[model samples]
Target: MEALVLAWPGGEHAFRLPLAQLELLQGATGCGPEFLLNKLNLGQWAATEPFEIIRAGLMGGGMDAAGAKDVVSRAFDRHP
Candidate 1:
């Protein structure tokens, strides 16, 4: 399954999942990230954190999951 990651302003991140997950996520929120996360039982992660990291990645033009995680952690340390 191929996943396309989308990051938007105002702290929004979406994973364009493959057909199966897409079906599930779409049903929950019509192709929105919050809906997908809720449907996939990952709602606990909270959209703000991932979205902030994603926003950073998108702005920098370097999107890597591990790198995003690292950036998120550092951001968390500074802000939290």
Candidate 2:
């Protein structure tokens, strides 16, 4: 499933996506934030294979796989 439960409106916060879905997106998304964001944003108008753009953009932005994962992990740790 290419879906994510956005931060809940109020009271409860349930920003979660299935691990399998995330894994699929990870392989497709490469290292950019756009496809991921678009995915989290519902992906209604997203490209068919946005992962290509994600990979290209990540390469252009000079962020490799490890670096991107580090950033995400740090973000979660710092915020939570």
Candidate 3:
């Protein structure tokens, strides 16, 4: 798959990233989806809008596997 791209302020440089990298990019580089979107003043994508859309966005199909278990456990580790 193609690596995703992330840019720095002023477009000075960009990094090619993966979806999995999102798990820790905010802490490591001080630039993740939330910060970048808000910094750019494009908060619409920072989180789902129109409240009603959020539920469908967060819902997912079942995955009965060890990795799936880890994922479910981690969701509880996070706060709403």
lDDT per model vs. reference = 0.46, 0.43, 0.34
Residue-level lDDT of model 2, residues 1-80, one tens digit each, is 22222332222212223444355456765634465677657855344344343333333344465653454445445654
Per lDDT, the best of the predicted structures is 1
User: Could you give candidate 1's per-residue lDDT for residues 22-63 as a string of tens digits?
Assistant: 343344344465554564476555445444434343334444
How far does residue 57 in candidate 2 sit from its true spot (Å)?
A: 6.2
Tell me how many clashing residue pairs each candidate has: 0, 0, 0
Candidate 2 residue pairs in backbone clash:
none
Every model: Cα RMSD to truth: 9.2, 13.2, 13.9
Candidate 1: misplaced stretches above 4 Å? 1-31, 34-61
Q: Model 1 — TM-score against the truth?
A: 0.31
* Alpha-carbon deviation at 16 in model 3, angstroms: 2.4
Model 3 Cα RMSD, 1 decimal: 13.9
**Against the true structure, whose TM-score is highest?**
1
Q: What value of lDDT does candidate 1 attain over all alpha carbons?
A: 0.46
CA shift of 5, model 1, Å: 16
Ten contiguous residues minimizing lDDT sum, candidate 1: 53-62
Question: Candidate 3, residues 1-80: lDDT per residue as tens digits?
Answer: 44223232222222333344343344434566566547557544433121211111122122233433344345434633
Q: What TM-score, computed on C-alpha atoms, does each candidate reach?
A: 0.31, 0.29, 0.24
